[model samples]
Target: MDTLTTTKPLATYVVRHADDNLVLGQRLSEYISWAPELEEDLAIANLALDHIGVAHHLYDYAAEVEDDGRDADGFAFLRDERQFTNVQLVERPNTDFAHIMARQFFVDAYQVPLWDALARSADERLAGIAAKAAKEARYHLRHSRMWVLRLGDGTEESHRRMQAAIDELWRFTGELFEADDLTDELAAAGIGVDPATLEAPWRRTVLATLAEATLDEPHETVMRTGGRRGLHTEALGHLLAEMQFLQRAYPGLEW
Candidate 1:
């Protein structure tokens, strides 16, 4: 017997991360056909696929803990947006290339530490999943960081766009490090990593990357909150509606 503690509490943790990626992946997929050019459209589509792939992988792990026969597809397609636990950061629309990179960079930085830590989770299954996913997160961060560096140091226009995106998106980031009741529950069960511990390494990685990119880290501000407790931006409900539309309208529907 594995004799490992349950990953049920860890489901709360995994769902938050996976749901965020799933929602964001859906948003990016929306932009695929509308990109300025075929090449750009293809690039957008590729990124969308990558995000969705990760989302599905995480969801599968979450479903494993459900023990109610709900698989990844069931969990993903069946839930309403309001019921989703993804952060507000992932729900934001992809405004531009810079905007997309900015969002990805912020999440990817935190994800690296998170998944790396989860690789050793007391829950055996989660630890295995984390070990595999951490590598994917690493590649994701690398891709986003390279784009950030290029855009920040490229032409004047690119720099302006990148900087604007950074400022606009930075406010939502505070939620990533915010610990709450659910976090407390999971942490108590040895299934979750402490958000506070993630902050230092996250800061180090982010600052070092921004400095190398020749971009000035914006001044620390008051910071924004919500998302973990389901208090999300206005955009999330609409997104959930679309994402869950088919599932809601046609229960038990499958491809």
Candidate 2:
């Protein structure tokens, strides 16, 4: 676990977003050489770099916000799963190709609007970071959106699998817009985008894509919670173990 815990609103907000990018970046990197096609492998690798690159920028900004002398490496490598503030959606495992694309599409859909909103933020640094991330997110959404259309409208088997992936992952979507007290305060101050306000647009984007892909909107189900507060599925622990192994094994080791 990290030694310094911060409660400053901007740093908290920045760390949460940084965690989102970093966790999703790590998850995408798992497909490094494993994508189904050569072109896709390269594309996914680039997308992973884009996400990790944003994470590095966000973490650096977070360290600046906290002003506790900890840097980007400290936040990215020193924190435990319980200290991570990412949404659970990003932490989900790559169960299969259908599941992978489904998950990516969902997050990409949310993040596109999110970064777009933040690009107009009161905090200039965050807005700068969001401006860059917004471009990458648009491309990420396009890539995932194309795959979703192909898989969902392709064959009976592909459609069935894609639908199944959507259904299973639906339970985790609610948390995307669940804003906490701190988040609400930050939103009011214009330092953060209130996730609650993004839901309507996100719904429009997602539902339209689902419709085009001939996929059904999932029925409302019990949604998972607590990722922002550090409660997580067992999956994050295993992931953190692997992700943090090098830094943990050799403290202060640098490339």
Candidate 3:
């Protein structure tokens, strides 16, 4: 790792963070009218909005770093699938309530620590964004943790579904901590936090939550990769097709 002498790593780092938030936010939005309960629908919508808000701020900063004329909307709606660097976890489909909760739980666990560390970044703009995002991440973590408990310890069917969700999604979790040249450079420069550093604390929190929920932790298995390298699962293609449709069909269309 070395100090970042160029803005490339910084912009890429910010873009990766933005991609994670935006993709997960979009997935959460799919539950707007489909949540099991009306109150739950509102809650999920608000959470999705929080994530999108974080993405907007990060994208705005990234645009400035790249010295590009593109704005937040451009980054959000114009990028092709191969340009996104979000982890494979967030791009997965929300198969069910249990699956959604499991995904959120894993992500928020990582995000809380990530944002906390980023709040101390040498880059002031990034620090500010992380400070605000850290607050939202805390709330998101709490919400998802409660759901994991409720579903994991509830009725037999609920318990089964929660376990299944955990098992299915566990493989994707490892990619959250994978480091690359961009992260390595930024982290050494104190402009970004090394994601690998967050793993131990994340595991502690997640394991405790699972224990309280009476859920068995899934065994470590073959891990998924390549999202950071601009490769993605099939789900992301479908997601981008729907999400970028309006913008792609009518470029720069404004309300």
lDDT of each: 0.79, 0.90, 0.92
Model 1: per-residue lDDT, tens digit, 1-255? 211112366666787877777887888787777765697677667767767887788788877776778888877876654567777888887788789888888988998998898888888877887787688788878878988999898899999998898888888888888888767777777878878788888889888988887788887877777676666788888877887888889988878
Query: What's the candidate order when arranged by decreasing lDDT?
Result: 3, 2, 1
Question: How far out, in Å, is residue 92 in model 1?
Answer: 1.0
Worst 10-residue lDDT window, candidate 2: 1-10
List candidate 1 segments past 4 Å from native: 1-8, 33-46
Pairs that collide in candidate 3 are none
Which candidate model has the greater TM-score, 1 or 3? Answer: 3
Query: Which portions of model 3 show Cα errors greater than 4 Å?
Result: 1-7
lDDT score of residue 26 within candidate 3: 98
The digit string of per-residue lDDT tens for model 2 on 1-255 reads 542247687898898889888998999898788888999999888988998999999999899989999999999898877899888998999888888899999999999999999999999999999998999899999999999999999999999999999998888889999999878998899989989988998899889999999999999889999888888888888888989999999999988
